[model samples]
Target: MCGIVGFSGKESKEILKRMNDEIFHRGPDEEGFYQDKYVNLASRRLSIIDVLSGKQPIHNETKSIWLVWNGEIYNFKELRNELLKKGHKFYTDHSDSETIVHLYEEYGIDFINKINGMFAIALWDSKNKELILIRDRMGQKPLFYSFVNNEIIFSSEIKGILKYPYYKKEPNFEALNHYFTFKNIPAPFTPFKNIYSLFPGEVLIFDVEKKKKKQFKYWEIDFLKTNNDNIEEITYNIRNLLEDSVKKRMISDVPIGAYLSGGLDSSSVVSIMSKYSNSKIKTFSLGYTTFLEHKNQDIIAARKISNILDTDHYEYFMSPQELIDDLPNVLRSFDAPFSGAISTFFLTKLISKHVKVALSGDGADELFGSYLAPRLSQPLYYFEKIYKKIKSGYQLSNEDKIKLKPFENNIKFLENLYLKSNGNFEKWKYEILLFKDEEKKRLLNNGVFEYDKFNSFDLLKKDVENLKALDPLNRALELEWKTLLPDHVLAFVDFLSMVHSVEVRSPFLDYRLVEYVASLPGNLKIKNGNIKDILKKSLKGILPDKIINRKKEGFVLPVFWWLKNELKSFIFENLNEHELKNSVFNYEYVKFLLDSYYNNKENDFKLAAKIWNIVSFKIWWDLYFK
Candidate 1:
C-alpha cells in the first residue's frame, strides 16, 4: 500500500517531490521514482510484501513499462508462477509491484481484469508513450487526476494534485450541490473544477506525446440475478466464498489484525480468520467514554467475541476532546467535505499501533441489502404499488394495510416532498439522501444559484429506470453499490485508515464474493423485513445466536448528543456566518439548522447529519480556499 503522484511534463523535479511529500503518511517506509521526458512517476512505499528490494517503480526487464501502484495484489504469488512459466523474469524476491509490470507486458491492459486486489495504479508505458491510471474494482484506494497546462497530474490524494505550480482552487459548484446529498462528493467529480476522481473500476489511458486521454470501465456488478434460487445452496456458497476471500486478504509479510466490532459482519470475518490461523488472531475495537442517547455496545460485544474466539484483543475509549482536537485532520483525510463516522479515524490510529495491516468487514452491508436505504427499499416498493392501486380505485387487502402501518409517517413525508420537490420521489433515494434538491434551493445562497445549469438530481437519477428488469430492492442495492459504497463509504475508509499508515483490507469487498452476492435473488438478502437474512443464516452454526442476531452498530458516534453539548461551540464557531456569506450556503438556512437542532429541540439524527455536512464543508473550504 502506498501513495503515487507525478505529472507528464518537463517541469522541475522539485514540484514532483513536493507533491510526493504531501502523502508521506501513506508510504513512510521509502520513496521511489521514475523520472523521464515523457512522464514522471513517484511512489511513497509502505513496504507490505517484499520490504527490502520491492521499492517501486518496478519496471519490465526491458525498462519499457514502469509501474508505481498502491495496494496489495493478494494473488501475486499465483500470478508470479504463471508469469515465470511463460519465461518472465522478476527483479524482486516476491513483490506484487514486479508482478504487475510482467503481467502488463504479457497481457497488456487486460491484466487489470485478471488481478484480484484493491489498488490505484499509475503505469508509464514508454514504448506506447502513454500514462495508464487505474482504480481498483472496489474504490478501496483513491486516485485523482487533472488535465492542465499541457500535462496530466495524478495522485493517490487530491492534496498531492494541489502542490502543482499552476493549479487553481476554483470550486466545482455542481459537486458542492451533490456533496449536500451524500457524505462525500461522488466520483468523476471532486470539489475542484478541473481535477476529477477516477470512478471505481475505471481506467484512464493518456497519450503523453499527443496529450490526449481515453477512459473505460473494465468491471461492474450488474446486480443481474442468476436463476439459482435455492436458499440453502446459496447460503452454503456464501460461506465458502467468504472464507476464501478472508484467507486471500490475510496474505501479508508484516503483522496483521482484524477490526472486530462484534457485529455479524466483523464477528463472521474474525471467526473465519481464527479457523484459518494457527495462533491467536489480533482484534481491535473502539468505544466512547460516555453517551447520552446513543449506545456503546460494540466494546462490550467485542470483548465477549474475543473470549469466544480465543484471540488477542485490544480496545480504546475515546474522549470528546480527542475528536475535537483531531477534527481538522479528519476533514483533511477525506480531502473534501465529509460527515459520517469521524470516530473511525481514531479506530485506525489505534490499530496502526499494533499492526501494519488490518482486515475489516466493511463491504458486507453494502453487498447484502442491509443498510437503511435497502431496508426501506422493500417496504417502499410495496407502498408504491399499494398507492398506485388506490389511485386506480382498487380496495386494499388486510396484508397491504399491515405493511403500511409501519410507514405512515414515511408516506406523509413523501407526500409533503412531492409538493415541495421538482416532480417525483424514488423509493429509497428521497428518504436516504441527506438533502434533496428542493431543500438546496432554500439552503444555498445566490452564488450557488448563479452557478447553475448543473443537476444535483443526476446523482440519484442515474440508471434508475434503465434497470427495470431487476426488483425494486435489487435496483436500490445496485445504485448504492455504485454510488454510496465506493464514493462515500470506501473512500472515507481508505483516506482515514491511510492517515495512520495502516492498510485496511476487506474480505467482503473481494469482487468474486461481490459478484456471487449480486447473482443471488434479492429476496434472500432481506427476507421478511430482515436485513442480510442470507448472511446471518449462513453463519448460524459458526456464530452464536447472541452475536448473529445482534443489531448492526458500526463504528458509530454520538453526533446528536455532541451537537447539543461537547461540540456545540465548535460547530457555530467553525460555521461562521462570515464564512457562510462568502461561501455557497445561505447563512439564514445554516442558522435555522443549528437553532432547530440545538435550541428548538428538532433533534432528529437526519437534521444533525445536515448540520454536520454544512459545517464540515465550511471547515474544508476555509482550510483550502482561504
Candidate 2:
C-alpha cells in the first residue's frame, strides 16, 4: 500500500530523498522523512485507511522508536482496543501505523507474532540503537535490504536501493542459476550480491555497534494430524474461514474490487465479496481476441458468475499487439526472469486501472493441492515406482532411450528432496534431454551437471526434512507455501500490481485461513482425484453451480500462438545470437526452438519461456545496471 526506503549507516539526506521519489507511484498521497546521524527513513504514503492521521515514519509517544511501514494491519482495530485497555494512548484513532509503536512497546520483537496482517515493517529502536525489519507471515509485502560500506540500506523495491550512490549493481550468478531452474529467484537471495530479501515470517535485527545482523524465523506451518472430522464439519469450517478472511481484507477507505477470472478461486472471492457489500461489487476480467478461437477462455464463465452474483463487471479483450507493446515495461517491472509473462502482466495492469486495491485467490491452488501435480500424484507415484523397477533393463536404441536413467534417479531423489521439486520430473526430463554437453559447460562453467547437487534442491530438502512427519500431500503443500507461493505467484502479483500502483490482497493467503485449511485431512483438500473438493463443497450453496464445477483454468497466455503470429517479428528482432550472446543461454538451441515453432513442429510455450527469460534479463539489465 506504500513505499518505504531508508539507510542505516552514513547515507546523506539527498540520496534518501531521491530513492523515496522513485517509488512515488506506490504511495502518491503523502511523503514523510526521518533523518539522524546513523539512519535516514523515508515513506511514500497511499491513504487507504485513516487518511488524515496515518502519516507515517510514525513514532512512539516518547519519540524513542520510529517506524515506516507498508501494508494493512487488518487486525489493528482489535490490537488497538487491547492496547488502549492496557493504558496505551493514541493521538489519533485514524491509522494502523500508530498501532505498531504501541505494539512494540507492549511485546517488543515478538509483536509480529501477535499481529495478523500483510506487512513489511521497519522499526527504528532509538533506545536500543537497533533497526529491526519484519516481513509478514505470507510475504504479501516485500522487503529488500543490502549491506554495503558498513551500512545497511533497505527498501520496498530493488530500484529504491539502487538510488544510493554506494550501492553496487552486479548480478549474483548463484541467483541466476536458481532463476534458470526454478523460473524465479528464491528468497534471502536477491539478483545482486550482498543484497538480500527477508524471507516470509522472518525478522532481521541489525546491531549498529557490533555491525552484526541476525535473522530468525518467527512462524512456520504445522502438519495436520489425520483427523476424523466429517465432511460437514470440514465444509462448515472452510466456509467460515474464507468468509472471515474476505471480510477482513475488505477493510478499506478507498474503492475496492475483485478480479473475476471466472475460475473457482476468483469467482469464490467475488461471491463472498458480493454477500458482504451493500451494493453490487465492481469486478474486472481480462481476455484476448485469440481466446475466441481457443474455445477455452473463461470470459463466458466470468460473465455467468458476474450475472449470478449481480455485480458490476468490466471485461477487456486485449489485442496481440497490445500485449506485445506492454512487454518491455512489464519485463522491467520484474527484477528477475519469470515464467508466465504476458497474461499476468496485462491482467494486473487492467485490474489496476479500475481499483486501488483488489482481492485475489492466488494461494488457493498451493494450499488446496489444486495444481496438476497434486491432482496427478497417484499416477506419478505409480509411474515412478514402475520406472524404477524396469528402467535399468528396458531395451531400446540409444536415440530412443534418451539416457533417462540419471534423470529417473534425479526424480526419485526429488521425492525425498522438497515437495516443490517432486512433481517436476517431466520438466527435469525435458531439461536433461535438451541440455547439450556444450550448453552445460557454457552455462555452469564448472562440471556441475547434476541437478540434485544445486543449493536450491538442498534448500528444498531441508524444508521437507522439517516436515518429516507429514504425508506426501501435506509435505508438498508445505513446500509450495514455502517456495512457490512466495517466489512465483506472490512475487508476480506484487510486482505487476505495484508497477501500476495497485495494492492486491489475497484472502486465500490469510495465515489463519491457510493454517486452518492445512489442518484438515488430505481427503478434504483433494478427494477422488479432484483438487479443491472441499472448497467446491463449501461453496456449493454460496456460489453458482456452474462456477463450482468449472474446470480449473489458470492464468495462462497464448504464448505458443503469439510466437507464430503477432509476436514473431518482435521476438525475432530481440533474440538473434548477437543480442543474446552475453546471456546465460545457448543461442543455437534458442534458434532451433524458434525454428521448430515456426515450422509447426513444437508447442513454443517452453521456448517462449526461454525468450521471455532473456528478454526480461535484457530489460532489467538496461533499467537497473546500465
Candidate 3:
C-alpha cells in the first residue's frame, strides 16, 4: 500500500509527475521515481510486500539514501534480520523498502525508534542534503507537508500536496473552525493554507542546505503512566499484546480479511483471525436498510459471528437510497470534511471486493473504556466514592446503583460534572464535542474566528492541560490519544481505506498494544459501569459469552430517520439558504438546525449530528473551495 509524493525546493522534474498523478487512487499497483540535487522522490506501488523486486524510490548502496514508502512495515522481517546482521547491503529479495535505507544507514534520525508500522516516510538524503518526513507510530499513515518557496512539499494525500507549482490555494479558516468543532480536522491542522499535518509520532527534519526544519516527537501514548499490573497481570499482558498484533498484520502479499463488525472490536479481530487462518476465514459485515433486525444489530451481530466462526461470511444492507446515493463517492473520498466512519466508505467498498488486507478493530475504543468520554472518567473519582456513601447514610447497593449510573438523570449533567470537572477540561471537553462552543458561536461566519483559536475545544486544550495527573480514566484515555484517536479515528481509517485501494490493519493500533493498554489502571479501563471493562477481561475465554458481552456497537446511521424521512429533499438539496449564500455558514443558524430538526417530534441524534455536520460542510465546500 503506497502513494507518496515529494519535493524539496527548486521544483521541476515536472512537479514530480504532477505530484505523482494526484495519488493515483493511492498506488494503482506500481510507480516510482527519485531525483537528485536534493530530493524529488515519488511512489505509488500498492503491490503489498515484495511483489517481485519490491520497488520504489528504494535505495542505499552508494545511492546516498533515498526512499518513498506509504505503509505496512509490520516489522519488515524483523527489520531485515537486524539489517542483515549490520552488513546492510540488500536489494529486494524481501523489501520493507529495504529496511528503511539500511535503518537510515544505522540509526541517524534514530531510525524512527526501531520502526513498528503504519508509515508515511519519504527519507531522501542526497548525502545529508537532508529531507526526512515520517508519520506512523499509530497515526496510521498520513503525511501532507508544505513549507513552500524554501521548498518541502511531501504527500500521501492532500491531493498529493495539491500538485505544487508554487502552490497557494488558501482555505484553512482555522481549519474551518476545527471542522465545526471536531467532526474531523484536528491534527497539525490543514484544510489548505500552507498545508500541514505531519503529526502522529512525527519526524520532519528537512534542511536542504540549511533552508532548515526540525520537528520532533518520536512516539507517545503516555496516559499519565501507571501500571501495577495484576488483573491477572493486565489480562495476561493484553492477550499477549493482541496476539502479537494479529500475527504482525498477517504479513500480507495479497488477500486478507476481517472487518467483522459484530462489535467487541471487530469480534476480537475475527476471533484472532479465526485462530491464525489456514482457510475458510473471510468475514465482513454491514447492515442498515433502516435498521429493525432489532436495529439490525450490526448485521445481526455479524450474522451471529458468522454462524459461530465457521467463517466465510458476508452481509450488506445500506439503503437510505444507498446511503443517499454514495454522496458524491463518500464526500469525494476526503481531503478534509470527513465526519469519520462514513460506513468506512461502504465497508472499504465491500472489503475491496473481498480483500487486499482488512483486519481492523481500530484501537480498541481509544485504548480501552469505550467512549462516554472514556466512561465519564472518574467523575470526581466516582463522585467521591458515591459521596462518602451518601454522607454516612450508607446502604446503597447494586454496586451503589452502578456508581450512580453516569450521574443518573443528569442533574444539570451532574452539575456540570460536579462543578466543571477538576482543573476543568470544560466538562471533559464538553463530553467529546460534536459541535459546541455555543454552537460554534451560532454557526461560524464571524470572520474566520479571528483567524485562530475559535475554541474547537481549544484544540486539545494544551493537551488537556498536561493530563493533570491522570486517573480521570487516564485523563479521558489521554485525550483520546490526543484528539479522537489520531485526528478522527486514524484519519478516517487512513482516508477511507486508501480511497478504496483498501489496506486497513489496526491490531488495536499496536504501539506495543498502545503501550500496554496505556499502562493499565483506569480502574482496569472502566469498571463498575462496565465500559470496556478491561476489554471485557481481555475477551474471557477467547469470546462467546454472547461475544464477550457485546454492547459498544456504534457506526449506526439512519441520519435522524433520514433527516425527517428519506433524506428530506436530500437534506435541503445540500443545505439551502441559497447554497450557503456567501459560504462560511450561519443561514439563520442553518435555519435553527433545520427548525430544531423538523420540529423535533423526538429522535434528535444530536440534531442529526448538526444537520449532517452542515451537509458535510456543504459537500466539502462544493468539493474544495466552492
Candidate 4:
C-alpha cells in the first residue's frame, strides 16, 4: 500500500524525492527517504498495518540494511514471533514491513522465501554494496527497474523511473507490437526500451561496485496433477484454504470492504467474508447507466447477495459519456498501454470513495478454470469429432458452406483436432485476438521498422513450450495463470487502485490456494460445460443458489453497445483518418472498420473490441509520446 523509488548510482535526494512525488496517491499518509554513498531510497506510506509508527526505509537492529516495501506481508506477525525467539529486537509494533529488514539480516537474500504476501521490495545492503529488488510470488505488486548509464534505477511504478533526468521518453515499438497482440505487453517488457518490469517471483541483485546486475526466479506454479484426487477431499481442502486465505487478508488496522460484483467469484468472496465477520461487511459494485438490459440483472443479483448477507452495499451507475470524459485520466494513470480500462477504472474509483482497502475476486477465474477457454473447450471437443467425420466423407450443401462463412476458408484449421480441442498452442494464442497477422501488417506503417530479432510470440511460445500438464484444459489454464492473470488482470488492478490510493487484496490469489488448485485435475475445475465446477460444489450451500449458478458477468462494461451508440461521435473524433495516417496504422483499414460498424455490415462485438484497441492506443500514444 505504498510506492518506493531508489537508485544504486549517484545519490541525489532531490531526484529521489521527485520520483517519490509521482506516486503520492499510492501513499499520501507520509513519506520517507534514506541515502548512503551507494544508494538513495524514497517511499510514500499509506499506513495500512501500523498507522502511527509504520514508515518506510525501516531498518534492522544494526541499521546496516534498510528496506522500502510496497505491500502487506500477511505472515509478518508469525515471522516476527519466530525472529523474536531468535533474539531479534524490534523497534516498532506498528509496521508489518519492518520484519523484512530483520529477516534479511537473519537469512540474507533468501529472506524473500520466508514471507507470504503481495510486495515489491527494494532492499539496500550497505555491507554488501548491493541493491536487491523482489516482486511477490503471485505478481500482486509491480516493480519496474532500468539498468542504464552505469546505474540501476528501480521504482514501484514505471513513471517513477522515467522521472530520472537521464532517462528519455522513447517508445519501445517491440513492446507496442506485443501490446497490440496480447492486449498487454507482458512482464520484463514495458512500452519503453531499456526499462523492464520484474516478473512474478523474480529477484534482481545489482552490485554498485561492479556495475553489474543479475536476475533469478525464486518461484512458479507447479502444474503437476496430484494423484490423490478424491473429489470430496479436494473440494473440502479448497474451502478450507480459501477461508484461511480470506482471514489472513483481513488482517489490517483499517476498515476493509469487498468488491461484490455478484459474479460467482466476487459473490463467493463476499459470502465467505460474511461468514467470518460478526459485523456487517461493506460491499461495493458498479453498473452501466446506459445498458440497463445487460447490467440490471447483475445489479439485482448484487443487491440480493447484499441483503442475504445483511452487508452495507453501495452501487454506482456510470454512463458512457462519463467514460469518455474520464478517458484522459484513465490513460495517464496506467504507466503502460492497457486496453481493459472502462469498467476496472470506474469500479476502483467508485470503491475508493468509501474504503481505502478492498478485496477482489481476480485470481479465481484463472485458478478455477472459469473463463471462456475452459467453457469453449467442451463444445469445441465435439466440434472436432464432427469435423473429422465431415472430412471422412460427409458432404455439405452450398447454403451450409455459405453459413460457415470465413471458417470455411480455413478448412484445414477446422479439421485439425488439436486446434478444436484447445491443444494448438498457436491457435489459443491467437484466439479472440484483437487483430490477426495480416491485419497487423495492414495497420502498422511499413516505416515502423519491426524490431529485427524479437518475435512478438516469443513470450507466448515460451509459456506454451513450458506447459507440463497432460490435460489440454490444464495447459491452457497454466498459460493464463503464468501470463494473463498476473500481467493483465493484476497489473491493471494495482495501477488503477493505487491511482486513488486504494489498496486491493485478492484472497483468490493466495499462493497456497493457487498451488492447491493448480495441482487438482482439470476435470475438477471444468467438467461437461460446468466451469469452476469444483468451486461451485464446494460452496454449494454456503452461497445463495442464485449467485452460485449465475452466469459470470465480470466487471463488464457496455463497450460494444456504447461504441455503436452513445460513444460513436467520441470514437470518430479520436480515431479519425488523419490520426491513423499520422501514426503506425493504415488510414484505409481504420476507416473500413468504422464504415463497417456504422453501415451495419460488420457490427460484431469482436470488431468493437478491435476499434476500442485502436482508440485506446491512439489516446495512450498521443498522451505519452506527443
Candidate 5:
C-alpha cells in the first residue's frame, strides 16, 4: 500500500521527490524521504498499518540500515516475536515493515527465506556500502530499475524511474514485438530501453562503492517435483493451506472485502473469509448490459453466494461509453504495455469505492488448470505428431504455408498448435498471441535484428526444457506462473487498485499455497476434460452445489458485442489505416482485422480481440510515446 523510490549513485532530493510524486495515488496518506551521500530513498505511505508512527524510510536500532517497502508482510508480528527472543527491540507498536531491517541484520540476504508476504523492498545498508532490492516470491508487487552512469535507480513503477534526468527515452522494439505477441511484455523487459522489471524471487545486490551489481534468484516453484499421491489427503491439505492464507491476508488494520466473481476461485475465497469473520464480509461483482436478455449467470451466482453468506454485496453494470471515457485513465495507469485493460479498469474503479483492501482469487487458475489450455492441447499434440512425421522428409509447402497464414490471425489457438508442432517455444509463452511469427515478419519494418527469436516465450525456453519431465498440465501451469500471472494478471490488478489507493491481496498466490498445489499430481488438478477438478471437488460441501458446478467463464468484457455496435465508430476513428500507416504495424494487416470485424467474419470473437489489441496499443502509444 505504498510507493518506494531511490537511487544509489547521485543524490538528488528533487529527483527522488519527483519520482515518488509520479505515483502519488499509490500512497496518498503521507510521504517520507531519506537522503545520504550515496543514496536517496523516498516512500508514499498509505497508512495501512501503525498509522501513527509507522513511516519510512524506517531505520534499524543502530540507524545504519534503512528500509523502504511496498507490500504487506502478513507474518510480521510472528517474525517480530522471533526477533524479540533474539534480543531485538522495536520502536513502533505494530508496524509490519519494522521487522525487515532487523531480520536482514540477523540473516543478511538470506532474510527473504524466513519471511512470507508480497513485497518490493529497497533496503539501504550504509555500513556495507551496498543497496539491496528484493521482490516477493509471488511477485504481487512490482519493482523497475535502470543503471545509469554507474548508478542504479529503482522505483515501484516505470513512471517513477522516468523522472530521473538521465533516464533513456528510447522504446525497446524487442519488447514492443513481444507486447503485440503476448498482449503484455514478459518479465525483465520493460517497454523502455535500459529499464527492466525484476523477476519474482529475485534479489539484486548493488555495490555502491565498487559500482557493481549482482542479481540472483532466491526462490522458485518447481512443478517437476511431485509430492503427495493420496488425492483425499492432498485435497485436505490444499483447503487448510488456502484457509491459512486467507487468514494471514486479513491482518490489515483497515476495512477489507472479497471480490466474489461467482467463479469457483473467488467464491471459495469469500466462503473461507466468511468462516473467519464475525461480521458480514463485503463482497463485490461486475455485470454488463446484454440486449437479447442474455442472463448474466455470474451475477446470478454472485447474488446467491452473497445471500447465503448474508453479506453486504454490490454490483455494477458498465456501459461502453463509460469505459470509453475512462480509457485514457486506464492507459496512463499501466507502467508497461498490458492488455487486461477493460474489465480490470471497471472492476477496480467499482470496488475501490467500498473498501481499502480486497482479497481476490487470482492465482487459482494458473496454479491448478485452465479450460482453454486443455481444450487446445489435443489439437497441438496432434499437430506436433504430424509435424514430426512431415519434418522427417516433408517441409511446409509454400501453398500450405500461405493457407495457414490467414488462419494465424483468425484462430490464434490453432496457429499456436501449429507453432508448437514446429518446435517453437512461442506458443508456450502465449498460446494465442495477437499476431503469429509470419504476421510479425510482415508487420515490422524489417529493421530489428533477430526478429524470429525476439518473443518472450523464447526467453523462457529453458523453463520449458527444465519441466519436460512433468505432465503436460503441470508444465503449462508452471509456464503461466513464470509468464502470464506476474507480467499481466498481477500487474493489471496492482496498477488499477493502486490508482485508487486500494490494495488487492491474493491468498491463492501465497508461495506456500502455490508450491503445495504445484507439487500435487496434475491429474488431480484436471481430470476427464474438467478443469480445476480438485478445486471444485474440494468446495463440494462448503459452497452451494450450483456454484461449484457452474461452467467456467472468464472475467472479460463483452467486447465482441460492443465493438460491432456500441463502440464501432470509436474503433473506426482510432484505428484507421491513416493513423497507423507510419507506425510499426502492416497497414494491410490492420485493415484486415477491422474489415473482418465490420463484415461479421466467421470467427467474430477473434476479430474483436485483434481489434481490441490494435486499439489498446494505439491508445497507449499516443499517451506515452507520442
Candidate 6:
C-alpha cells in the first residue's frame, strides 16, 4: 500500500527526496527516511492499517534496525501475539508493520520466511552493517534493485531508482526480445540492462563494506501434490481460507471497496465481505461500449448481485478515445512495455478513483480453471484424435488447415485449444498483416531474441513438455499464473492503480488459497464444460442464482470496433510510417497492419497487441531514456 526507496553508499539527500516525491500518490499520508554512514531508507506511507500508529522506517525501542515496507501482512496479528508471548515489546498494535523490527531482532534474515503477507521489505541492520530486501511469496508486491559502482539502489518502482544520480538508462534488448515472444519480460530481467526485479519468494542481502550481494528463494508452489481430503472437506476448507483472506485484507483505516465484475471470483469476495460488515459494502464495476452489443454483459450481472447483496455500487463506462488518450500516461506509469490491450488499464483507473484500496478477481481464473480454454479441452481432445485419423495420405483443406493450426503451432496450444477452443490465428494474422515479410525479418534480426542461439519454437516445446503431467487446461492455467498473471495482469493493476495512488489486493492470489484450489480434483473445478464448478457450488446460497450460473463474460472492451471508428485517427497518428521508421519496427509493416485492421479483411486483435507493445515501449523509452 506504499512505495519505498533507498540507496547505500555515496548517498545524496536530494536524490532520496526526489525518488520519494515521484511516488507520492502511492503514499500521500506520511513519508519517512533514515540516513546514516552506510545506509539510507525512505518510504511513502498509504496508512492502510494503524494509520496513526503504523509509520515507515519504524524501529524497535533500541533503534538498531529500521524497516521500510510495502504491502499488507495478513497474519501480522497472529505473529504479534506470538512475539508478545516471547517477550517482544511493541509501541503500537498495528497488525503487520510493527512485527518487522521485532522479528528481525528475533530471527534476523530468517524472519522473511515467518511472514505470510504480500510485501517488498527493505530492512537496514545498522548494528551489523547489512541490508536485506524481501519480496512476498507470490510477488504480489514488486521490488527492483540495481548494482551501480560499489553501491546498491532499490525501490518499489523503477522510476524511483531512476531518480538516483548514478543510475544508467541502457535498454536490455534481451528482455525486449523475450517480451516479443511472451508479451511480458520475465522476472530477474527487466527492460533496463542492469536493473532487476526480485522474483517471488526471493530475498536479496547486501553487505555494504564488502560491496557484495546474494539472493535465495524462500518458497515455491508445488502443484504435484493435493491434500488428502474429500471434496466436501476441501470445499469447506477453501471457503474458510478465502473468508479469512478477505477479512484480513479488509483491515484498512481508510475507505475500502471491492471491484465486483459480477464474475464468481469478485462476487465471492463481495459476498464474504458483506457478511463481516455491519453496513452495505462499496463496490465498483467498469463497463465498455461493447457491453451494449452483447446480450449478457458483466454490468447486468453485477447489478443483480449488488441488489441481492445490498452493497452500494458504482459503474463507469469508457470510450475508446479516452483509452487512446490515456495510453501514453499509463505506459509511463508502468516504466516498461506491458501490453494488456486497454481494458486492464482503464478498469484499474476507474476503480482507483472511488477507493483507496480495491480487491480484484485476478487469481481466480488461474486457480480454479475458469478460463474457457481449459473447459474446452475435453471436446478438443476427441476432435484432435478424429482429425489425425482423417488426415492420412491427404492434405487438409484450407478451412481444415486453419482449424488445425492451433494444434500444430506449439505445445502451449494444447492448453489454449482446450481452455477456450479458440485458435491464435486471428491474432497471428493481424500481426502478420501489420508488417510485410521483410519487416518481420528485420524485426526478428533486431529483436531481443538471438535466432542463432535460441529457437523460439523449440523453447516453447520444451516448456510444454515440462508440464506434461498437467492436463492441457491445468498447464495453460499454470503458464498463465507464472507469466501472464505476473507480467500483464498484475503489472497493469499495479501501474494504473498506483498512478492514482490507490492500492489493489487480490485475495484469490493468497498462496494458501491458490495451493488449496490447485490441489482440488480437476472435476471439482470444471464440469460439463463449465468453469469454476466448485466455486459455483460454494456460493449457491450466498450469491444470486443468476450470478452463480452466469456464463463467464470476461472484462470486455470494444477495441476492435473502436480501432475502425473512434480510435482510427489516434491509432494512425501514433503508428504512422514516419513514427515507426524512427524506431525498431519496420514502417511498411506498421502501415500494412493498420490498413488491414481498418479494412476488416481479418480480425487484427493480435496486430493491436503488437501495436500496443510498440506504443508502450515508445512511451517507456521517452519517460526513462529521453
lDDT against the true structure, each candidate: 0.83, 0.75, 0.78, 0.82, 0.80, 0.73
Give lDDT tens digits, candidate 4, residues 368-472. 886656554444444554565676887765644543433445556545545543546556546655665556777777675364435565656676888787676
Error of 6 at 299 (Å): 1.6
For model 3, name the residue pairs that clash: none
Q: Between which residue pairs do clashes occur in model 5?
A: none
The list of candidate 4 runs beyond 4 A from truth reads 378-386, 390-423, 448-454
Per-residue CA lDDT of candidate 2, range 360-396, in tens?
Answer: 8889998888754454443344445445444576543
Span of 10 residues, lowest total lDDT, candidate 2: 428-437
lDDT (tens digit, per residue) of candidate 5 on 320-423: 88878878788788856566644766877777788889999888888878746543443344345556555576665554444333232344456445765453
Candidate 5's TM-score reads: 0.91
Error of 2 at 340 (Å): 2.5
Q: Of the pair 3 and 5, which is ahead by lDDT? A: 5
lDDT at residue 185 of model 6 (Cα atoms): 72
lDDT of 6 by residue, 1-626 (tens): 78999999866788889988977877988999999889888999988888878888888878888889899887888889989999999988674787988998998788887776789999888887889999887777889999888899999888888888788778777666566556567677788889999987888999999889889988766566666887678778878888888888888777888888888889999999999987778898887654454524678888888998899998877877678777778777777876654465676666666678888777787777754445544435544555444546444455444434334344344534433423332232122223233334555435432433433334344544555225545665665566566666777667677778788888888887877777666656765456787877766677778777877777656665556667767767777767665566666756666666667766567666666556666566566655
RMSD of each: 2.6, 5.7, 22.2, 3.9, 5.4, 5.0
**Two-way TM-score contest, 1 vs 5, winner:** 1
- Model 4 compared with the native: what TM-score? 0.94
Candidate 2 steric clashes: 0
Write one digit per residue (lDDT tens) for candidate 3, span 524-613. Answer: 767766777877887898878886786766765656666687888888877788877776776888888798878878868777877888
Better of 1 and 6 by TM-score: 1
lDDT of 5: 0.80
Poorest stretch of ten by lDDT in candidate 6: 425-434
State which candidate, 2 or 3, has the greater TM-score: 2
